[model samples]
Target: MKYSLASGLQPPFTQRESFVRSHPDLYWRNKGIAAYEQNRATDAITAFRRAARYADKPSQAMIAQMLWVGDGVPMDRVMGYVWADLAAERGYPAFIATREKFWHELDRDEQRQAVVVGQAVFDEYGDEVAKKREDKALLLARRQITGSRTGHVGALIVSLRLPNGDFETVDGALYYADKYWKPEQYWEWQDSLFEKLPEGKVEVGPLQMPPKR
Candidate 1:
């Protein structure tokens, strides 16, 4: 099933904005996409890296593509391979294919370099480290919104204004914790937002180089 934070009528506008602010990974991903669409390759790469802190796979793959081709940054096949490998960690078929493509293109020395550099890259942006960052942000956002560190409001009803301007009441504790606070659930939900790839040759490279600034 597709995941979406806003799948249903979400919380109040202010709460939604606060949640977005807390999740810098999502914010940076959106920023990177916007900059990339505007042909600001340097800015897009920068934002993508920021998103990589939380193990945003799409951003990680984008970084790999850009770095491999020397689009915005200097071409570094080793680093590109490193990013692609990280993006493949969740066993996504598209990402795994991309990682393998990068591996096949590397020479012995570059392959060795990728292994060495990959250790450092994983130390910083791999799932183990990055997921912790997301968990912390999730906890903080939950606390801020619920005014409860445990996210337990105990039968309190919270009124949420939908996008259609209709207000609905929901169980405050369950709504905040299950829907937004729990890290694993939240990540799973967010992951659903990614577009489903058709079964075929997944394009592993950038479509076109961004215009040189």
Candidate 2:
């Protein structure tokens, strides 16, 4: 079964549990959605609030919306604005409009209060989003460069034994590794290996090149 918050339909309990077990960050958000659909506002609020602590964008958006409508929590537009702003900052497209709506509707005093609250939220969660994104990028980069020496020094040139029982020359790169260097001969040595390469069975494939400075 599938779950779509927009559709207001929750996935099977077992599936949701399994999903949450593997991705604990999603636990509160998914639980909140299920609770909301079941008309359990208090439970939904609790779940959504917990999710927000983990920087769950949709949960932040939902808490903002719920606060705006006084669905489960007391109607507090300032709090709503704070969460909406947080959600929007997280790049949750659905909450972008909600954040703008809150901004345009709130008065100066309310906006000021929201700014304080939003700043607190930012201070608490900003690094969480950034770290999550960085982790994802590293994971993706590793997958993309799997089985191949994508990043290497000196133009990433590589020698490999071809299937035809012949050695072939190729280009490669170092896999997002750190490099330290200085001008060996006034830019003549464009590439230098400051770090030792890991020992392992190297895969021979596509030619990769060092990034141009």
The number of the candidate with the highest lDDT is 1
Q: State the C-alpha lDDT per candidate.
A: 0.74, 0.54
User: Model 1, which residues run further than 4 Å from truth?
Assistant: 1-18, 153-179, 190-213
Each model's backbone clash number: 1, 7
User: Where is model 1 poorest over a 10-residue stretch in terms of lDDT?
Assistant: 1-10
Name the TM-score of candidate 1.
0.73
- Per-prediction TM-score: 0.73, 0.53
Per-residue CA lDDT of model 2 for 100-201, tens digit only, reads 777889999998888777777777655455335434433444434443444224455445554457665543342122310111221121111111123664
How high is the lDDT of residue 171 in model 2? 39
Clashing pairs in 2: 150-173, 151-173, 151-174, 152-173, 152-174, 156-172, 171-208
Question: Which numbered prediction scores highest in TM-score against the true structure?
Answer: 1
